[model samples]
Target: MHDDHDHHHHDHHGHDHHHDNRYSDMQARVRALETVLSEKGLIDPGAIDAIVEAYETKIGPRNGAHVVAKAWTDPDFADWLKRDATAAIASLGYTGRQGEHMRALFNTPETHNLVVCTLCSCYPWSVLGLPPVWYKAPAYRSRAVIDPRGVLAEFGVTLPEEKKIRVWDSTAELRYLVIPERPEGTEGLAEEELAGLVSRDAMIGSAIAGAAS
Candidate 1:
């Protein structure tokens, strides 16, 4: 079953919006500091933009997406994905901090899992490109562990209460999401199509891997 997701929306409830943690404000501050250096003839602001663009585009998600695509197609590869995510992923030419301490948790029809950071939102920057806005929501932080199923239902996912839920505390240094085995009926599909069914939480373990219709 393809789990419903509302990626179009960004939940703002319980946001840590004290202007102290705003992304824009953070960007502005960095820009401001750079401008000061430029005025003093110490740096070139032009260089930062190019560097940021390369990382955001040329390096990040492409690596993670490729790993996911490969795992979906190879059974032995999936084992590599779980046992030692970094080396397993590095074998494909992708490596580094975002995946440095990578841990892959495989979900199944009989088991379901979800990832959350009660202290803070830690994510796989290499594959995900960037964390979704809702991934850092205060509502998500407070409620996910206490009411995993209810939160997932909001996104059109409903799991049986009999299944025990495990919520991993994400930290600044470790943890990664790799979703579980894909359901049947997806046997003939290509990697690109299969990727679409991987909801953000599917990889994190909240829902089972869905076969696209």
Candidate 2:
């Protein structure tokens, strides 16, 4: 009986070890992809650490917030963004390496858009500044694709069943920016004031733009 129990325990340990190995392998794959993208000029390797540090310490999501606010207040600019996201975003002087190729996904009452880099964390540094730590995590990358609704819920975002959720996978060649629906009660607010209401999580499609306090 002792030998049999030991064998079962050993098997369990082996199973757990296998799972750990798999997780580690996934992380290594993501790192390899990041390297390749960096080499191809799709990602700035040197800037990755620097930008993350800047945003985490000094910079904020104000750049993206301004863009969203402008789009909300200016119909012509919104049209331009819809037609050519890269040029429009650049016109606002928010252009950089990873953000060279951009696409804007607008959220509507019928559909919601979520962005994720399943292979690696490709983000718009010029607009959103730097990605959050969770954005680069293995769990978020995998789960964002598999169970996006559940992931959003964890971020305190809940959508109605009638609304369809669309997840956009960011690649080395292209990145996505989510244009969250403008909140109500801001009709009288100026563009700058309106920008204050936009949040990084909202632009990431993990949360909605909350009404100004």
Give Cα-based local distance difference scores for all models. Answer: 0.68, 0.82
What's the TM-score of each model vs. the native?
A: 0.72, 0.72
The Cα error of candidate 2 at residue 190, in Å, is 0.8
Candidate 2: pairs in clash: none
Can you write out model 2's per-residue Cα lDDT over 1-83, one digit (the tens) per residue?
01111222347445655322233566667778987887888986567778667667654578788889999999999999899
Report the lDDT tens digits of candidate 1 across residue range 129-151.
Answer: 56667878999888988988888
lDDT of 1: 0.68
For model 1, the superposed segments whose C-alpha errors exceed 4 Å read 1-28, 36-47, 58-65, 97-99, 206-208, 211-213
Candidate 1 at 202: error in angstroms? 2.3
Instruction: Give the Å shift of residue 73 in candidate 1.
Output: 2.0
- In candidate 2, residue 72 scores what lDDT? 94
TM-score of 1: 0.72
